[model samples]
Target: MSRTPSFEPYEGPAGGWGSARSLGNILRREGVPASGTLVLGRQNKVDGFQCVSCAWVKPAKPLPFEFCENGAKATAWEITSHRCEPAFFAKHTVSELLGWDDYHLEQVGRLTHPMRYDAASDKYVPVSWGKAVREIGQTLRALPDRRNVVFYSSGRTSNEASYLYGLFARLYGNNNLPDSSNMCHETTSVALPPAIGVPVGTVALDDFAKTDCILFFGQNPGSNSPRMLHPMQEAAERGVPIIAYNPLRERGLERFTNPQSPTEMLTHHETKLASQYHQVKAGGDLAALTGICLAVLEMEDHAKQARLPPVLDHDFIDTHTHGFGDFLGWLRTQGWAELERRSGLSRSAMTATAEVYARSKATIGIYGMGLTQHRAGVETVQMLVNLLLMRGNIGRDGAGICPVRGHSNVQGQRTVGITEKPELVPMDRLAKQYGFEPPRETGLNTVEACEKILAREVPAFIMLGGNFVRAIPDRGQMEPAWREIGLTVNIATKLNRSQLVPGRISYILPVLGRIEQDVQNGPQSTSMEDSTGCIHGSRGVRKPASPHLISETRLVCEIAEATLESNPLTPWKDWASDYRLIRKSIGETYPEIFFDYDQRMWEPGGFQRPLPARHREWKTENGKANFITPKGLAEDKDMPEPDEDALRLITLRSNDQFNTTVYGYTDRFRGIRGTRDVVLMNRSDIARLGLSEGDRIGLRTASKRDDVRRELGGLTVVPYDIPAGCIGAYYPEANVLLPIWHYAEGSKTPAAKSVPVHVYRGPAAA
Candidate 1:
């Protein structure tokens, strides 16, 4: 609301002057350290700290500036010299700071001390790490049940820290390990294991270069994972057909001018990324994918009729997969007209897209949260896997499924046993190695954890990192739920809204950033698993903002040492002293995946964690890939058919934003500037609703749920190229409109992608 937003066409492709401008803005705000020169070229390559933002993989070799625009911003942000010490907190009270926007709160600068809130003065003051740990431990000990406490890990945390946190939680008799993964990729974890063997993606970065065809399903790489754009650009240059399916035509998926290319950087030459674009309506991915599959099936049937070679990989299907015949029968039940009706694409378009997949010997499918953050997000993911399996895309060079995960180590956190439910976490091995019986029962996820907190079942809420409040839906209740928590401990690099919405007893634990020297276990580096499963070492080159800062691993161990004093076998101090011991413990527990963990990280190219699914092996109940067939592609069963005046609201991230971290108000790709409270609606829809471009509107959730009165007022509507009946708004701000109970039933991921809303008048048109 600072400036009335202005709209213009974003003419240039992604990674042009716009990105450079964004990067400059970050550097100017967060005074870059002297060690930036050392970090610039080495960030994502071998022996460098992974970008703390997205989980995009690193190249084998290094780039002069190895990071993308946002990655560079994140790097500078973490390495800034600005400090938010006791004096800063003394000036700004929790209530006063809560009124400030997310960007300003973060811009206030890095948290440089472990400060506990003194309710008497309504201020946070410096506290010793020992005292902080003791207070947290005492609170944990005092809990009526260990389930009353929750341990939430962010994707930004290191594998060592997450592993130790998981261990500590189980040892403390609480397996309530809610994490950032539950918010973003829980669908992948739930859907993939049944469809394929692994919950994580199977593709490596090299697969992009070797594949002849790739399908970008509901992914905006330029904004979320800019590094992935390079591979897509290269794949396009090779004449490989790159098809994109999304409700919004994201510039990242449309075209990319690689800033890494000196030629393109100077000449302004651009590479068109998507060969063919399919603009499906919101929550129509399952339908779109089903249409493509239907077309493929039709092609196979035609091939048989014409006495030609089989179009489908019958051999692979017969050998490695199960339930194909049943899948085919289910496909027969669904008609092309229905699929096309729901998908918002023509039959010819779907057929042409299917043809590309049928002809290509090696093809890869890359998807993101757009497909996953739905009512049937897990099924949507499984549908993508089904399409790939039809052609035997798994376990082959240049062909696999790639879930372009957001956050640096979101996938890594899960791999290192951060999930509430047991995956590859060897409980027997942990019991033998650490002399404790780890709980095998399912624990809380991001949504479940919040629900428990709201119900007053959870007393202490602990987050390793991330702005949980802004990121989660149902903030109408969630905000209050966070307030009700008895104890809240947040280990963070910068100030976020979640810190302000604290419990009765809250502490802000400032910790070392990825660019800060973490000399706890010697001058060592932390490792993160990229989206493609490449584990690489990250060593911070800059000095800490404050000497009082602690490492997340050390912090977790200290709390565990204090809390689990009765457990003699848990060597918290020993693990804290040397991070290698923690990794050794991890390797011992998860030998098949994290084998030779310490030595593997030191090796060149680090290591590619093995994917058993890549070998065409399934870990399903029957030990074979299962084709799950939903009755129809439509996701929201509870969603009522919108009135002609109603709109399907899909939450989005601007080019300047990642998750809840807002860099600027401008969304250059959408051609909007100087405001965050804006909506993108179809031109036809704007006309139908009698709302002209730039008209202010308020959104009311059109749900049957009586208790949910979520609304966001004063949003400027900007008519764009989106499909009719669907509208777009920025996330966290729009998260208010999404109900608490409205989430993916299978995975419990907030269905931020689709929320039926009634648009009403707000203020007057400018």
Candidate 2:
């Protein structure tokens, strides 16, 4: 039933006519040709719902078409005319649906009603909301321990819903609340607080306009966050240097043509983005960053000896930072040979990059999962901070470290206390406000939760909005372990692999999407925090896909009310009816941050959360930004050197995909079409493995452990412009090869970016 993929080089600029055509095709295919256009026009507007895509901040001043190609796809995907009602589910068994791919599962369309899995029939049947809630509540209450339950959240959930979900978990008994952050930017959360006294980015959207230089490390703005290309284009036009480092030279960083620019579209002109591009090897970010920092130190030493101006910012260092002398000593001890070998970049390239950084008065460092999804993810982020600190890039206009977040409200979900660590949140304040003893013990994160599930320690799993089974690593183990649970509840907008792989007692509760009207007491609005720490309002304008759908806020409240004994102090019903009450509670709970949450939502640009680091006021225990030195040049010191036959594998997302959701088979930017089962390898590596361009290859995990043997086969080899020792494959599909235990040291984020594997010219071992 699948079409064979065709491979050819793509020679078009990103986001010009190609983007427009893709958007048109998606809109038409989704059956929202005209209506999708209207919906997209309102996205990111003052009164419009936020685009349910990336967390790129909206400009203070609006444009006619602020939405990008991926944004249009997300909106159309949500507001499509196709429906998956009870009748549709009744016709298909869960076994049958499990055979379908992710795209087809979602393409079947939005869920229409609450459905319960019927074990006897192996099908789903419509169930009344009242009965479903009551039974699920009773089942949860009957669990032996609250710790046996895991509550997972997605980035798409609104702040109001996320807050309530957190409250419900704490009130129920444990802090077993883990969200999407555990898999993506958990490294940013873990690494930044010690270095800069903040877990989020310090720079605002306006900083892009005034920045002297932009340094991108392991990020592709063109596909991950297309809206970011607009700012990069402006910076490029202004002649600001943009230096990029990644294993793959992403087209978004190479050249971009804004679809909104009529001049560019008519003239077929493209703006070159990255002034200098370095294809650093996979898992080489830490060494590469160290090399750059060492170059800066050398420049400073030379400047001091020659009586020229100093390159390093001593004033900022002396006043606001600690451990500089120790860090410098450790940094100088690192040899250039190791750095060059690990980074897959020449010393000249690193020195040149440092020269650009030293020349610029203000610089911005931007990164994504490529840096955060490695064993040394935390260390790599710290090294990046050290690089910025060398020139005093933090807390100044047009300068800061930016971690490009994936989901719209991923950062917001963390801000609202959707975390496994209770100490990170205000447990005392929550207990005082709600009249309940909140749990203080730590809970399970994504990796730990799966471990517990595999051991049969977990009894129930409740997801707010994500395809947990698909997105998490080690699908080979997780999918089967997930089915062994006692209860599984999925509150979502559409059918996904997670829903199909049901537990003993599973329920699929359909909820309203971001683009749909959420009316409770009156027309309501929810808030989301952007990647840049800006919290803004999002109001839906379109009709709901089905009348049976309920708002996430109401659903969370109903489930909480049904599960727990009536607590007048909590007032679940009152808060559910009016979201303003929830905001009031949030304001009271975190007065320092959300004191005037509702009033500020109507402001010209909403409101920016107070970032102490932005004011150079460190909030760490020592009240100073600290320079933490990593152990060695290698990001993952524990990872053994790969065999000569092994190559590092990096999982990637196609241009047509968002996270685990695949919209289509085509990866426009990468020149991949009609298939997701291909491996992109360097020409030299392809030849070294005795493989041709079109050879079907098998990849086996090079993990040291012998108990588990993971292998992926039947992948067509496509030569790419990547580092000689690395290969690329699409995510989720490649997740099977990744071990559940292989994760970042401090953050425990799955090390999906770098996995040692062996490539061969045949089928996989059974």
Candidate 3:
């Protein structure tokens, strides 16, 4: 291939990279030879630090070489030999660094000093730990109300850190802990609890081993979570039908060449995944899932009329569910035409999928952004729960609603009560455990937090770990919103857009990465939950990047103590001086599952948390899963009407990427190289527009802006394997196309995956 791609001088947002191959390509471009020593001590290990890439499920029985292509890159990115120490920062001012691309900044390597943005010279000057803490605390205190401050947590934060961070926020009299979840799976959180009592995934790792079939929707496991490909490969081998519902024909969904399969590798063979692949359009999952559920219910009726056993699990449904009659009535109202049209699938395809689902002894329906970024996002998830409930799939082995997460510890962060609205039970328990009155009032979510900052209603912001500005939609609004804050503190390991956007005073506190040593008051290990619901312990074999770098647990405790007037005990203070106390706090607050967390983490593989649904129990308010009837199909009014020159533009990830952090520019699977400017267009639509491959174009949103004429124009176009009426662009860049008001109903997550816009031949007039 063209000499492996490397980092270039990208002049876009901070903390962003587009392609995976860029790293190698950039290094080669810079004439930096690949460090052979850097590749050592990274392979052939189980029970090592987990991949910090996408939230893919890992192997329960750790394989000798279990990592995927993305996983290896994620690890290398974190543990690279390159270092951006204090000397490096001194060479360039914040403004000069800002001129560099996201890829260039990260490729320079790890941040070795705590730096604060000095606005005078527009440079990042080193600051003492004492000054950093006091600055942040003073800003929080200066806020009109504690509610003015927001604590945004990334999925990369350890469970111990998340717990301490939430406790600090609550003790400080606010619950505005808008996490990454609000952007990805808030639909599951808001809708699932109402329908099934649990807002998270109901299936466990063991459930995958037991289930007869796996039904995947709106999720691309290959790029999102390559680790899941293994379990899928296993299920496929066991004769379990693995069905995929997606708009694009994903290679990850097709046959996979297992890097760990020695036999297959030698023979140059591969295993086929996704026995059945259905190409559903954007926002078509609800119709597809609804059709399948309705067909299953109809087949049951036919079987009963024929004096055969009902296709539905009537016994399980009778005992553990409500609203069956209403669901049946609603099913009758949705005709085959609506199902076929909405789902972009033929009626026969729907019938065939329903047949496979009915024949299976148990099934698990897994989904992600595809379903969550729609106007009917919440209802779509509820319907999936209903589908599982009808088959008694949930509370049974291997069958239930599994909302896959994007970040590694994102779900666990929520589980530890990192939320805008903390549950009463968890809050009361936290107060009792920490000797402080936790906040009862609901706080601001992501969208609301940005609004507060924009309105000058918020004075300060502290992010645990995440590229908040780039990650959040409406970058136009978000960039200016940061300036309104009196102080902004980001507890991060590296520099990103969040670091560059300054308040009156801004501090970027360097912290330890997950793969680094986490030394506390005493010897202890931290644990996290994999996307597939497996809890595992993580211990770093490598030393901390710097002795100056502290664990997130220590940093949060210090800040909480500095900012709080209530004399809240520094939970991580004593714990940092030992990690066992942190584990004890986790066990105390969530004893049911985290019981003996300290001891359990030490156990070889770590212990699994109890998923009641795995045993066929519904935790809904009614003590049963209720089948929800969706209101009706809704369209993206943002798109120009059918006759208008509008095509839906959805954002996607390259194999080398994980969320906003791009490892490289080239997409190996898509055959695109050396560019993030390429847009994946439907072949037919591009042909109709008289556009060819590699054509430079501008993409304008159908919904014009009233305040500013902002549009995601001037992008390169490339025909990809995607459906008609659909186009694809990378996030944060495409984020400009997503208006602040354009969000999923109820969940408030921007429809980053599905946007409608018009394509032009060249850049719009600037």
Q: What are the lDDT scores of the predictions, listed in order?
A: 0.84, 0.91, 0.74
Which regions of candidate 3 fall more than 4 Å away from where they truly are?
A: 1-47, 58-60, 520-524, 566-572, 635-644, 704-708, 764-766
TM-score of every prediction relative to native: 0.97, 0.99, 0.92
Tens-place lDDT per residue, model 2, 1-766, is 5787899888998899999999999999999999989999899988898989989997778789888989889999999999999989989999999899899999999999999999999999999999999998999888878876999999999999999999999999988998899999999999999999999999898999999999999898888999999889999999999999999989999999989989999999999999999999999999999999999999999999999999999999999899899999999899999999999999999999999999999999999999999999999999999999888999999999999999999999899899999989999899888888999999999999999988988899999999998898888888888889999999999899999889999999999999999999898899999999989889998999999999999999999999997888889889888999999999998888898888887665568888999899999989999999997766554455655688999999999999989999989889999888899999998877788998988888887654677888989899999999899999989998888988999999999889989886775631
Point out the higher-scoring one by TM-score: 2 or 3.
2
Model 1 stretches with alpha carbons more than 4 Å out? 33-37, 763-766
The most accurate candidate by TM-score is 2
RMSD of 2: 1.1
Instruction: Using lDDT as the measure, name the better of candidate 1 and candidate 2.
Output: 2
Better of 1 and 2 by TM-score: 2
**lDDT agreement of model 1 with the native:** 0.84
Highest lDDT model number: 2
Model 2: how far residue 572 lies from native, Å: 1.1
What order do you get sorting by lDDT, best first?
2, 1, 3
